[model samples]
Target: MISEAYSPQTRNTKTVKLQADLVVVGGGLSGVCAAITAARSGLKVVLIQDRPVLGGNASSEVRLWSLGATSHMGNNNRWSREGGLINEILLDNLKRNKEGNPLLFDTVLLEKVYEENNITLLLNTAVYEVEKGKDDLVKNVTAFCSQNSTTYIASAPLFCDASGDGIVAFMAGASFRMGAETKEEFDEGFAPNIEDYGNLLGHSLYFYTKDVGKPISYTPPSFAIKNAEELPRIKNFQLGDHGCKLWWVEHGGRLDTVHQSEDIKFELWKVVYGIWDYVKNSGKFPEAANLTLEWVGTIPGKRESRRFEGDFMLTQKDIVEQRDYYDAVSFGGWAMDLHPADGIYSEHNSCTQWHGKGVYSIPYRCYYSKNIENLFLAGRIISASHVAFGSSRVMLTCAHGAQAVGQAAVLCKEEGLLPKDIASKEHIAKLQLALNRNGQSIPRIALNDTDDLVAKANVEASSSLKFKGFSEADDWHPLKFGLAQMLPLKANETYSFEIEVDASEATSLELQLKSCSTPNHFTPDVVIDKKEVDLQKGKQKITFTTTKTQEQDHYSFFCLMKNEKVKVRLSDERITGLMTVENKINKAVSNYGRQDPPADINVDSFEFWTPERRPKGKNIALQMAKALPIFEPDNIKNGEVRPNANGNTNAWVAEIEDKKPTLHLKWDDKVNIKSIKLFFDCDYDHALETTLMGHPEDVIPFVVDNYTVKDASGKLLKEVKGNYQAINTIELDEAISTDALVFEFSKKERHIPVSLFKISAYN
Candidate 1:
């Protein structure tokens, strides 16, 4: 190569032009999901990110675990994990990166995006300019990449702004709010006071540690704060705490979170180094002598910035009341968590969280900008009041809502309509049906696709599970606190239960039968009956029959109040629609067994009944006088996918001893089918956190590991092995005309029985 001679005063950078049907800015989970979803839905998408890697906060650069509705299993939201593309990502992560290595997680995200041919990925590029057309539409966007010394001009008919700071939205002159609103503004009694709790949420930095088997020495930089004792929350530190466990190592709520991000990062670093120094040399953590810092986040994970306005702003009332919306598109269940302005130095507790009795719906109106016609708002910047953002700002929740944005973009292109037009009555149903077909579950909404051939076929199974309760007792569980067994029952039915227990001494056991006022909710706020039984010192059997029948079908809680002298028998058998929960606290999420907030906060106070993580959470060993026939082959055609508190188990489960579980669909005439989809049990109640936490198994135990599909002639059409996902979409090489179809599942000697939620055939 030769250098240029007598060059001009300056030379411009290389410029490139790109076009797409949809342009997504920001590589966080929300934007990544949006781009991938739209790309799969037949849209040419361009994904732009300022960072080198995708996943934003969930990337190796920042490393915060992705959490949503399950909330670490700290609350009462059961079987509430987010579905659709995000669920697939989480399941994939579990299979490949069960150890939760952030680097591996980054690769998973990259692989997912790379698998889609319609997506164009641009990384290490920041968008700094925008070009607008007539009628307040965005015609094009300009971005510059310092790493490559290149400038990119990308144009698209629709745009989505998932950048953490809403950079594109701000440059496009979108209306936004930077701080919290007044308590009286939206009747949000839980709103924070500006002078006390502060107006904005803050940024946090995390680190990882490892043991070298030898003493490791560390010296702090000149900028590191030597006065570690001055930290108000210093006593809360521990040698083993790292990653998201140190989420409280935050700052910059009082500063400009967007403009002064560097300053905020520096402050967080100073605190992190100071905290490490304290752990190393402070003489309090003798066990940390061989530990050394393995990695530290280069940038802090931002909590909140500028929130853009949409057609309708979500408020505290919507979350607390669990309100339903006509334009509901998504849902959120994380508690409303708010931090203090002083962050690590704050005198108040690290955070105050208040949760609703159940998950609430999110409307489609809060997805797109109100003034910016062609713009869409996603992630933490979606339209919501500060109090509501405290719950909806989580990564999976943001990603789920952004998925709706992706699907909406498809409808916008197909109908030649704007994003706002999709919120109308004429198009809302279409949007919901499309999302449901894609495996996204909306709360309280069932898929009613008339095009599915299964709706017309008669479903018959070799054997169905009869609800007779688990009888094998494997261990004894002490009743140190209140314990409840969740069981599904029908209306106008009297059920009898027989429980075996061991008593340390003579005591009286209080058995309370309870159910939620709302049939679809898990909160057992209504007490139906109670009984007091006396127990002797030895083993005993207690039998109780319900005196009254419930008015409607719902899951009732058979609760045994705390009686330290007694221990109940537990079975190792685990079922799809059954679980045992305890009234306990998860301290990490501030669940104190029961939430008794001050009356002025305008929040509800209730007990938290959460399930234990497996290998430990076993069902109660009891017997029912009569078996209930709830799991029938006809359930396969039901509109609901998962078992609900208000509805019966919308699944067909084979008997435990059924050697070869089979399902047959018969039709009067031959039908041409091009595709077949099957929905299985992956245990939606488990919170599949993306990073840091290790899981018990790679594949969900309840999922069908091996299965085969056959046509009317008994010719093998397709076979699936080692399946771990909830939705299985199989496309035939050519359309098959048959009068019937049969599905056969391999029997495995495991705790979970073979089961299926739904099956559909389409041409």
Candidate 2:
């Protein structure tokens, strides 16, 4: 076929006009979350991405692991993983790709967005221009797609700029900052000196390697750094280390990370290839002979660029002090981590981090532009000082905050309001309640949902867990470092704990009872009592009694100080609200048992009592004086869905022996229930890092994999199998009028009990 048109001046690509209730201008984790949440909340949405796939930094291109409050279980954020759509995504990834393949994670994000009918996903579309309406409102966004050579004009009432560089906000003339703030500007003592530390963090590139079963050869290009073996960070490179493990291989801090990304990529490639050459040619790594480059990132993972301004800028003080916000919408626990400006080339440490005693709340005021009326800020571009961005810039934290922005967009459309209006006193609670209803956990805010019919019904389970404590010893955990058993205790209650211990020699063991200054926090800063017990050489029982209770309910730490000769018994029984943490060092993140920075740094000095990963982190076996009745059937009607800081399980857990556990709900009058929402326990303490981390199990052991719902006559209403997600919503073909409902569950694992957080029925 011959084409016959050499017509006029120039050919114009096709231009498409799209409209929706909300327009999301990025396809990163945050933007993907925002688009999905808004669409699920009944908003017509348009999702535009500059890249070929979703999950910006977490995508296959960048290969960064997604993490949030759990912080790799390397900190004191017990059961503090993020919730909502991001939680769903991570759990889904865990179920499908526990091996954490970046490509598989890409399909998960794509499937989630594609399944939502309200979302119009446009990939490889870069938004370059913005149209403004009256009173500084965004009217429409104009983007061009090089893949298809088409222009797209997407118009919506509200817009969210989760683009890492704040492209939309920048083009719309929004207020923003690109570099570090002065110490005097935000009273941040951890602020870096712009000259020595550099004002901005840099970008990072990662590569993966595989064993080819035979010897392989590598020849670097002429552009590669020839003397990579002489680099300052040469010692950090290991033979098998790849991807984010080699996160120190970075560049482009002195230059503009956005405008000079290509320069950074070239430098990173040179360094990466040069490092491979050194591994092959140098005599140090003999084990790398068979290792071949499996994959390498095309684009560098950006750490910082332009952070748009909103009504309030989060500062280091807020994170360090664990400040509460009136309009708290989300939370973050990643240490205030900042990278050296010179990146891998610097002689200084690759990064510096400081952790707060507990997780801190993120306010709604930091979610929308201060001047741009319709612009919603999310991701790393949210309003925050450089000191705060070190913690909030992580992908999961950004996605958690974006879930709030998504719900706020829906509220703005419904109430005929702007983004700023949702943070006010009258509207903030509504927004928070909506977020909680959708599985987003705001630190102290419980969802006081009055519409849930389960709240009005009388609930009774076949059997509820009585906290007599796990006495079945599976192994003996030696006291290499300080170990503590975290138990939720009742106020003014006398409790006695009997622990089995083996001492190598006759020695005195020091025991302490401690609790956090804040009742709901996990930080054991306040000591209630201390005692020293004499022990013999052989195995024996060590008992402690405590009647000194706090003014309110809280988690008590039964701490056994570091004793090299003592070994305590550990139970394999894993419960919903119980755990044991040790005071030790995780050098990977620079945690050295305790943080004692210079007093002038304005950061707290505290020990990091973190939990060990699975197949190892077992609870201490003990016998309680009395059974604690915290896990009652009524907990299913409570608004709280996850384990809270107060140590309340917020769930009804069946006894381990109750094989066919069933819950019965009785109501006075028949109620119309078209849908049912169930919340399950997913072990939030486990950080489901998206890539390069192998999980012990595909489905969290605590989740109820098989369950069935029955109506008054014991007729099956709904059945679920192999469920792994935390939130499950079941919609019936038609509403059923029933005065009673019965729920039967089967235990997935023998050691882990079946538990349900909350249940709701809607007409």
Candidate 3:
């Protein structure tokens, strides 16, 4: 182990023995997420950040926008919820900051970490020395801060090196590597023929400006590139100067970005100001009178430095082949975006790019030090070759990697095991389960027959079913529905069944059954009937049941609609000319008293298993269909309507023939509803202008039904009341329970324009 001998004077200067369950060194995105996750999991967390803010390169110091795992071209998928603290911070920013500037971003991230009860953040602090036990486990870290000018010792059961430079791992005797590896070492497509440890990608200090209105005279800096050939081409310019557009490439002779940050800063400042001067003085921006500088990132955005050594090192080849690891904990999809070893100014060189076929899973073994038992690493510091680092270094992926490491750290703490020891299959399964519960999408797995049968038979099945769509009619077939068919149901007996679909493409499947008897007089009533349930992207399911009936039924079956919508109904009531028994049975069940049934009958339990294919393009038709019902009201009225002697609105009437109606109403914008009520005119039969009331600003009109409405005390409200005949009034008690609400309606001729009267509170 690398040990630094301390003198008596050094020992005497330190008084406090700071301790925690985990110590995260670095306040960057990955480090902050790590600290938050560990802390939230009930671990005592201490986070040390060198700067006052917490977001690292994407922080106010650098001003880089957070990018996710999909296409860098603004089409990639975002990081999943298992990204943990980062996800929370992102969601908060998305809600609070509509402009999405960097200053507000820093405050939000800092506040989130500070608000955590289990976290202690140390700002403006740097770890100067790391002490290790004889067995190579990190013992303690001594950090010094200019704010105090005194060295402080922080000891923790586990340590995470998120410093981007791998400082803690390096000082604690962990093996590591720097710069590009040889092709022979990692077999990477972009690797050099021989190892070039000295030549690495440098860092950048980015800045931006807003082009307001006025023209301001300016001049280009002396160092500004006058010719097209001299300008860096890789950093493409955007419509506005408020982005990562300037490359200012540097080369082999002066490529130390971290060490020569002052020089780089000077050059970057000149470039920024020079661009503005050119736009103003050259008359290129004649109307740009009020061009104002918005933000100048102070810290150097370092891309590469040191990488820690772990039990298994990730390589670029693993990404190309779409390799899967049993211990996989994270996935990276960004291409190998490698900057030239020389600065952006090099004439013969620019940035190098290598795209991946798809996302590749990262194993937990790559996150911990090979020699140090208690030491873990995340972000750009994790064990990976330089080429592999190019792919994994993006902010969102790094955040995900940090979350995995943090969760694993908590697991290790709870189980009293080292990181390496916890890298087994069983432990990985537990970790995967935890991540899944937090909304992370892992790779898919199928279940065996025995597991499938058992899961279906249980009333509360824990598993979900899979359905694959086929283009050819002959290819359509039944899968594992026999168990459901054979299940015994007595006369007047009620049973609930759940159906889950994990198909990547929209699929049509038939639920069929063989012979059985009809319901008797003692059977319960069938109350619910819903047809055409649509499953959108990702995993979706539906549950329904017939009335409580002890009837041995027969020949019950469902035919898949060509459009792939699932139909369900609870009925013993026979339709005209349909099969019926003398002793018909239908039962009624209370909606409030029933529990949610299992996901799917005869399905297997597995993690992250989505069907191989799904319908292509946007499901616009499905979305529209779902939206149509909310706009159509049963009653309506054109003018003033009055209630009858029975307290019912006689003015409200259903005009079945005219096929057109109007609705009018006003609300307090703070209510919820299961359905909308419309007062229409006597001239129309159908309701139009289906105005809905009480909605939150953040709730999108298209996604209204996805969430449940609730009141201040979290009580569920009843459905709204009305029909498509004439103007009618609805009480707040009939609306769904919610603290906030909004109005939604359809544009039709027969609908009456709504007007607000008065809303009263139920004391």
How does each model score on lDDT? 0.89, 0.90, 0.51
RMSD of every candidate to native, in Å, equals 1.2, 1.5, 19.5
In candidate 1, clashing pairs total 0
Q: Can you give the TM-score per candidate against the true fold?
A: 0.98, 0.98, 0.59
Candidate 1 per-residue lDDT over residues 550-647, each given as its tens digit: 77788888888888899999987887778899887799888888989899988988888889988777899988999978789898888666778784
Worst 10 residues of 3 by lDDT: 616-625
RMSD of 3: 19.5
| Quality of model 2 by C-alpha lDDT | 0.90
The C-alpha local distance difference test score for the whole of candidate 1 amounts to 0.89
Please give the clash total of every predicted structure, in order. 0, 0, 89
Clashes of 2: 0
lDDT of 3 by residue, 1-763 (tens): 8987876664544445579999999988899888888888899999998897888887777766665444322111111122334554655564455355667778888888988999888889899898876668888998877786666789988999999888888888788887777766655556742333235777765556676566554455677544432355433444354544343323332454445666766765655555555555655556556666666656567778788888888887777555788888787766566665555555433555444434577888989999898998988988889888877887777888888888888899999988888799878888765653332344331112121111121111111111111111111212221112112223344444454444445654433222222211111122122244445544554544444343343222221222323322212111110111111111111111112223331111111101111111100111001111111221122111211111112232212122322222323443344333222222110011001111122211111121122244445433332222122223454535444322232222222122111112221
Which regions of candidate 1 deviate over 4 angstroms? none
Candidate 2 residue lDDT tens string, 483-594: 9988888677767889999999999899888888784468787788778999999899989887577655788788999999999998989988888999889877668898
Model 1: weakest 10-residue lDDT segment is 639-648
Scored by lDDT, the top model is 2
Off by over 4 Å in 3: 1-16, 73-83, 148-150, 192-198, 219-229, 247-254, 261-263, 274-292, 348-350, 445-763
